[model samples]
Target chain A: MLLCLLGSYFFYGWWDWRFMTLILFSTILDYSIGLKLTDTEAPKTRKRLLLSSVIINLGILGFFKYFNFFIDSFREMLLTVGVEASMSELNIILPVGISFYTFQSMSYTIDLYRKKIPVERDFLRFATYISFFPQLVAGPIVRAKDFLPQLQRTITFDWNRFNSGLSLVLWGFFKKVVVADSLAPFVDLCFEAPETFSSIHLMLGVIFYSFQIYCDFSGYSDIAIGLARILGFDFPENFKTPYFSKNFSEFWTRWHITLSSWLRDYLYISLGGNRHGTFFTYRNLMITMLLGGLWHGASWVFVFWGFLHGMYLVVQRLIEQPFRSLMTKLRVPTILSAAMSIAVVYFFTCFAWIFFRAPDFEIASTVITRIASLEGFHPSTIISKFMALKGILLIGVLLIIELTNFRIHYIPLLVRKPAFRLAAFALILWAIAFFGTFGANAFIYFQF
Target chain B: MKQQIFSRVGWAVLFVFVVFIGDRAGGWLCQQIVKGSGFRYSRMYTDKAKCDILLLGNSRGLGFYQPTIEEITGKKTFNLSYNGMTMDLGKVLVEDYLERYPAPERLVIDVTMCDRSSPEILASFVPYIADSDRLKGLIRDTSYNVAAATSVSHLYRYNSEIFQRALYYSNGKSDNEWLLDRAMSTSTLKHTENQKYRIDARFIKELKATIEYAESKGTEVELVMTPYYPPFAKVVRGLDIFHEDIERGTGRRVRDYSYAIEDPSCFGDFQHLNKKGSKLYMQQLKADGVL
Candidate 1:
């Protein structure tokens, strides 16, 4: 994963050769320390060591990623005091995927400290597991127990696993190359200068972006899992048809499944969970989600994104009893109720994604303001510029793919007849080959 | 377990075979329909053999370089640009065109940074890398000495009926249809505004290859940096290091037309030129005797 991150940074022209070397040296030192620390059975000593490691990892992240953010915030606070104090800002280059793998690395010591898993004695295996290139950048956040065991075992090739893996990889490529990348042009056209676009275009852009992000990140996850499967390792599924999710709770369960679950297991549950009564439970939920949002980036947009979801969960919890009763009284059909819930959740999620997608709060506010305005209602302009017909068709196709099949695991079943399956596979491949954007567009989550 | 695995493998292979056959059949069917129409396969727009000039680049090339250049110059010309072509792949296209047609007297290669410098250019050009047989047929069909009847059969097979329908449905319009519509459209053709001319190291490499190839073939290659809007052009000019590197590497005179026309009225967007701007820009090029 470190290699992939470094490779991506180099490929993207975002970092210099020196930065890559620094990252490599840091990674090696961190890995060695991790291995050495794990070898001992001193619990109290391990606790101190783990705390120090957390400090060091977070210290690196804080300096590189969040120092500027904090400095600016502090500067703003100082301006309010009428005593002007400003510091010359250091332009720190954030190492790609530091937040992701930092948490991943922390999970190892945390797990070790909890006695949930044994410390890996083999330094190479331990390092490889942590920096396993496939899931290293964006993660399934492999547990030490789950991943370490697989690494320790002798890898034997399985044909079914290989076929399944190949199919997944192909599917991911299709989603990313064909659908996600195709949507990018329209999304970019609309969002480039949002002030010029109508509410309709702005709304359409957001919708396109929501799908683009899904296809981008989930596509990465699919490729990662597929690659791991090819190498005789099983990584967890990180997405589960998230768009079809019936509620915010269900959406969390579905979208970025690994990260959500990790937050649930490590952070939420650790913060007294729902055990400390309703008030504390709400507080815990907010805290977990706010941090989860911050985990995405140092930006306030991410914080707001996390806050919105956190709000949804809290509201859902508050209204659960009454809403359940109301549904029962209304005699709402199960499917209809589920659909309504999903729609509501999806709408809110899409709104929040604007913040996630926008460069900063100013752009986010502009988008919100434009969406609020009823001006620029020219349907013709929207139709011509946005390729409204094609955009709708693409969205329709994506929905059908998601809703009809919901489960990606069932894709193999669609090809019951070998001939039919082969034809479908070929068509998909040809489509991707001819029409797909196989350009060097990076996955969206690579920034985090 | 082994038996199960073998069975699965057998099925997968069979599936792949069926798909290939289906695709070929689909492609063949599409060829038949397009061939039946009176459309000439090579010059769906103009006579290939009669053309003296070719405009080649990506979409920016397509949208900017008006095919009327041929009429204006009293020379038959073709804009052979596909939407997203890079200089590296443009080499193959130039080679392919030369293989069939007599080398055009002049070739206007749009040196857009997005086209030349983007690493993603290869992916964009993958679709256009036609197979050897298809390419040979294209060359033969476009040749003047080829009798009408001999070319007809070759064109017929190349234009697959099923593929044509699929393309029409997917694209919602044919390429010929789009070309016709563009010709009739009242909307002004926009050239790049805020044209930044940064002759980076990468740009120099591509420029050398293009220039060397063109020079060898007795075709003069004029490195024209199409005008972009102000700030964008400023950004490009600001890259002193990149400019220095290009000058050091190529030893070629890099023309900067970005700010040559200062009137904002000539620009439609930050990077594209308005119709008026294009005329003025073309006239300036003519005055400079670069065309």
Candidate 2:
């Protein structure tokens, strides 16, 4: 565990050494707060302790990540109102993994204050859990309650776990470099000059992005989880075939499982959840998602992405009964209905991604408006048939994996069968070498 | 448990073996087809005898009409440039050309922006690199040392998008033309000024060295600064500095035609000329007494 903490620190230090001090400060503060909260049963003391955790973690996060963003937005607002503002933006580097560790560490103190988890007196164990390098920067956001117990027990090397974990790591690498990187140039072309491209190309770009983000993020999660499994520390699965989800509610549960769960247990449930009347229920839902979106980055576009998803959820809920009855009334076969539902859910998810991806609402709205207003039967003239086919091939791989993953344990099973496993790895290797555009980009979610 | 572990390990070893074999086999086949392709540019890179009057640069040189230049100049001219070719790579090729064949009467060097850090020549002439020791040294200074070391057997050199290029060439997709000449509005072709426009020290050094090397072999080297749309005038930087540096480095005046053309129809894109544009530009060159 001591070795793990040092390794994690070293891993993080590589990106920016100065940020290590910030992580160290966060660790000590959270650990101290947890200890203090445990010693005092007084309501006010506990409340103050939790508030300190919130303020300190959130304060650090805000200053590093959102300070410049807020200042710039305010400057823009001032300009709009014809008021002169002269505050210059800072050259602050957002400490990598600041959001992930801050949230993970904050959860420990929160859980302790809520009396849900026992006070972890062992500082080494808690520190290790918070700073575990595999998921430190981009995470499954491992819960202290889940991880602390695992830390207590002696971990042994189980072959099944190791093989399964190895399989995931390989699969993750394939998804990231081969699939994501290959499609990136095309997506960048469309986004860089949204007006230059036809409406068909715009649609292709959005569809490509939905897969790109999922593959990019989920690929990171798979590697993290796989590495943890090999190390004999189990991190929860981060993604579970999100595009296969039938509704926005199901999509949330499947996509970024840890973040969604974190929001629900900590924020939404705390805000009276669904126990309250419909008004507050919807408000809580909106606020939870809005905050969740803001958690991704400091940008208003991300907040809008969250807003769109929130709206999707609220509307889906209102119409779930009607939609269900309508499905019944149509008398479509079960498989057919399920397919339609997944398609519908995936379409809305792709629509929201424009907001997530676009630099601002204007660009996002332009893309959407162009998509809607497009006339004539013009297919994409810019993208070649070969390039279009490649996109379809990559997206098809994900579809096959998810659809197959629903039934069989695809990655693990491939691992067990040596010939098939080796062949898969070889295929991934070839794809990466030949198809992947050189210059491996950093994981997309690492910024968050 | 022991049996299960042993069996699994056995298969893993076998898989690695197969992948190694596949990579080598695939690389060798791709290398052969690329060399054997009907594309004349690929042949010009290593060919000894085509050094009469050479045209050299990146895509700017590749896009130049060699047939028209030969007709006008009455000297054998072939474009020795490929897309993504760098100044240093051009220097190496020039030196190699002088070594293997008689020096050309004139080497018309298109002095395009020397900003790209990596040269695509490493991937383009993998087999030629393997066939010669001197050819291998050219890439060592660039970011190909690590790649070259691993690719000693020339397997890793074939790791890029070469298979597709080879397939396209073999399938006769290598059109002997550059610009699409597609009907695009001048509004669409309006160039945005790039913020970053600076030359690398190494690129300038090699470019100067290339001039000196050619001059030593009695080959007169002339530089032509490719024309861009007037709107992108602000984006093209360091031409004056580049000119001064060349004169200081090699004592030769660079014949800059950066503002030579202005008709919107004469341009195919922001920087490049279409076939029609190039034909007119060739006549402009003869008329202006610049060539």
Lowest summed lDDT across 10 adjacent residues in model 2 chain A is found at A375-384
> What lDDT score goes with residue A281 in model 2?
90
Which candidate comes out best when scored by TM-score? 2
Please list the C-alpha lDDT of all candidates, in the order they appear.
Answer: 0.65, 0.76
TM-score of 2: 0.85
Candidate 2: residue A191 Cα off by (Å): 4.5
- What TM-score, computed on C-alpha atoms, does each candidate reach? 0.68, 0.85
How many clashes (backbone N, Cα, C below 3 Å) per candidate?
27, 0
- Alpha carbon lDDT at A87, candidate 2: 100
Give the Cα error of residue A52 in candidate 1, in Å. 2.0
User: Lowest summed lDDT over 10 consecutive residues: which window, candidate 1 chain A?
Assistant: A378-387
The TM-scores, chain A only, for the candidates as listed are 0.90, 0.96
